[model samples]
Target: MNLFTDIRALVIDSLTALQSEGALPEGLDFANVTVEPPRDAAHGDMATNAAMVLAKPAKMKPRDIAEALAAKLLQDLRIEVAEVAGPGFLNMRLAPDLWRGVVGAALEKGRDFGRSSMGQGRKVNVEFVSANPTGPLHVGHTRGAVFGDALAALLDFAGHDVTREYYINDGGAQVDVLARSVFERYREACGLTPDIAEGLYPGNYLVPVGQALKDKVGDSLLDKGEQFWLEEVREFATEKMMDMIRADLASLGVEMDVFFSEKSLYGSGRIEAALEELDAKGLIYEGVLPPPKGKPDEDWEPREQTLFKSTDHGDDVDRPVKKSDGGWTYFAPDIAYHYDKVQRGFDELIDVFGADHGGYVKRMKAAVSALSDGKVPLDIKLCQLVRLFRDGQPFKMSKRAGNFVTLREVVDLVGPDVTRFVMLTRKNDAPLDFDFAKVLEQSKDNPVFYVQYASARIHSVLRKARDAGIAVDDATLKAADLSLLAHEAEMAVVKKLAEWPRLVEIAARTNEPHRVAFYLYELAGEFHALWNRGNDLPELRFLQEGDSSATQAKIALIRSVSIVISAGLGILGVTPAEEMR
Candidate 1:
């Protein structure tokens, strides 16, 4: 169903036939041959570099080989015309029947239209939204959550066994901070003026957690010292926060297959086990690290610390696995967690970290590399900041989240569908501007609206055809005489449709779901352009008043486009609009 792959195979078969007929040398490497859409659609449907790539290897002139290859390719029924273009580059124009076949394929596939088997069922772990278990997820976690979830879905659609996971940061001092904050609210619940000190969480969301603590423990923990209550309160408060976090994620349509806790890595021998595996290979050592370059920490000094030889892989220097106080550094638990992932046999790993964690990327990759011993690969994607805008100015800060905006606020304003689509409107590494006014704008400039409008238009045609007593189901539309869809403008829409499977493979291989969003936008643009062209060319219109047969042909073409759009939107966690409101 992939036109480019299909055509490339045809080119390969022809090259082999040329070799068999003694038109070329016995042995020639054809690895470099590729069939792809030409830079400009004006060039042709697809262009191949087979003749050019083999010219030097086969001792033939570029044009001489192209002419022969063109002649051989033209003999095939799929290719209507094969012409040798600049420097032995063979450009091809497949018959309109081939475009018709693409539509038929998409209609048959439905939601699985662009699904690919490129991963070959390899297991991949996509860990994202591992927000510290200190509070409800904010705007930053929302982006990471959506990006990771969409990415995992994209990989699954591309044939990877993807597991969505969240790593909780409960082992760190942050959880202790959460306990103290909740304790203040607990005292307030007990009718005392709680100490609202600096460094304590000021959000009112934890007020319920404090009130719940009094109900559970009664007067047992009342007026107790930090040493007496910190442990029990930390455990109780973390569970409450996690419940709140889960509810927040569920509201946004995110579900994690695994919720790994950082606390579990401590005192579980897992950290020691992971480092032991590395140390067994001579990758761990106790060493006094050199001070960092240029403006080192004012408190920095040389200290012999247990370090991992991260430099052996790709890091700039060896990294500390343990602090000077003999407790493991934050990176130690992280390495252990990933080592556990590798031990569990994930063929590949991807971590979705926020942009501020950009500095940790290299060390993490180095650990996965060392742990897997080059068998498995790791990819870290950093989601940059999303600045919210409304009323032509910066979005106001959330009162609940204090200075930081909560994820719920953005979802409440623009809605989950609009928020998800707008978040994916840019590359993950690039900063995004979420303008409330622009996203809600029902115009072409708004990508979510543009894509949804295309689907809505398709639904409108379906409803009209149904009301007119014409069968418009996929089975019927797929069976239509698609030969009537041979018009160039109509075929152009098919060309974009043909690119879906290829786009899926590319986006999944790159671990980028935004590419799906971008491709859907382009497909919508093509459909819209063809719709506009129908105004001038009556034959190209979906509804031919006099002939139901010809009308079904064009409807079949656009309906297939709608199917692919729905599939792509599904991967992006977006709902296709049946009717624009």
Candidate 2:
């Protein structure tokens, strides 16, 4: 049901005909030919560059090729007008019935209307929001979580077997700090004044982890030294922090298929095994890395260390796997983690990190490339910072998170749907300003609200038609007299609907789910434009008074709009509004 694809196929067939007639060279490459919407609506519904691309290769003038191709395309019933516009661009106007079929196709397919098979069932692993299990997730983690989750959904819709994953940083020093902080709470549970030290976590969220520890083991570990209780409390507190993080994600409708533990990679011989694989490939060596560029490192004396030959795989320089003191560097475990993923047979890997981790991207990619031998591609998306505003003023930090606004704070203020939608309104690498005042406003400036309102308006129209005894169910509307939908405004909406499948594939291929949000906004604008036109042109309304045939045809159009909107919102993990308040 992809009209553009269908039209492009026709163009290819016509070019083959030209080859058969010897009007063009035998076996001319047609891969560069493309059929898409014209830059200006006045040009035509679809434009093709077949003539332009083939002109140089065929040793013919572009206009001659375009005119010949246009004549052949005009023979098809689906194409009404095919004309040469610019030097070689062939713009086409499709038959109204062809555009009308889009509405019927949407009804028949429902939410699966725009789903694509471009991914061809490839397995993709998306890891995001690997926030340290030290406290509740903050605003920065929220953006990553939302972006990652949406990307997974988009890939799923585009026919990829997507595994949503989280890498737990509990194996790091941060967990030790969490244990010390919880130990303070454990002491507080023992009716003593706990010292909230400067280098320790000061958030009250750990008070419950403290209470849980007290409940599980009572005051037994209260007076114990750091060695006696550090391991036991660190394990207990990290589990609590992960539980809190899971709850936070649930509030925003994000669920991970796998929660990989950094600690699990340790003490399991996994790190050594991963490095051994690299060592077998001669990628591991003892060497002294040159001083890093762009900054002075006073302590940057040359020290021989175990390193990964990352430069061979496109890194700026070889990276140290083991520090001079022989402890594993932070990069070692990450290498092992990706190697484990490759061993699991995922065809692709995607990591969502905060923008601050930009410098780590190249080395991580190099490691994955070496491990997978460039068989599996890795994409790291960096989410820039989010600045919160309320009443045109900077939002203050949360008392729970201490120095940052918690994800719960934002979700609590505007609920999950708004939070997810607003977070994705901006590109992942672009700074986003989350203004409570603007996002909550019921206006077109708010993309989430505008898109949701369009869905709500469709539901409202369907309800009215049903109450008036006009059958508006999908089955009925799909089988309705769609030929009666001849209005120019109605055709414009159908054209927009026709672009959904194409848009889905583009967004999925680029690994950008924000494109879905942007497309939904544009589709909503088209729908709203059509709806506003109905006020001035009585015949343009969805429900024509006393004309059941006309009413069904128009209802079919807008109903299709809702179908696509719901699918788009579904990919974004946002609930399509049934009614607006």
Q: Give the best candidate by lDDT.
A: 2
lDDT for model 2, please. 0.93
TM for candidate 2 is 0.98
Candidate 2's residue-wise lDDT over 1-581, tens digit each? 78888999999999999889888888689999998998998999999999999999999999999999999999999999999987988999999999889998999999999888889999999999999999999999999999999999999999999999999997889899999999999889878888999989999888888888999999998667899999999999998999999999999999999999999998899999999999999999999988878889998899999999998999888999999999999999999999999999999999999999999999999999989989999999999999999988999888877688999999999999999999999999999999998999999999999999999999999999989999999889888998998877888898999999989888899999999999999999999999999899998988899999999989999999999999999989998999988
Q: Give candidate 2 misplaced runs (Cα > 4 Å).
A: none
Put down candidate 1 lDDT per residue, 1-581, tens digits, no spaces: 78888899999999899889888888798889999998888888899988888888888998888888888999999988888887788889998888779999998988888788998999999999999888888989999989999999999999999899999899988899889999999998988888979998888888889999999987678867899999999999999999989998887889999999889888899999999999999999989988888986889888999999999999998999999999889999999999999999999999999999999999999999999998999999999999988867998887786568888888888788888888898999999998889999989999999999999999999899889888889889888998888777888898899999999998998988999999999999999999999889887788899799898988988899889998999999998999988
lDDT to native, each model = 0.90, 0.93
Which candidate gets the maximum TM-score versus the true structure? 2
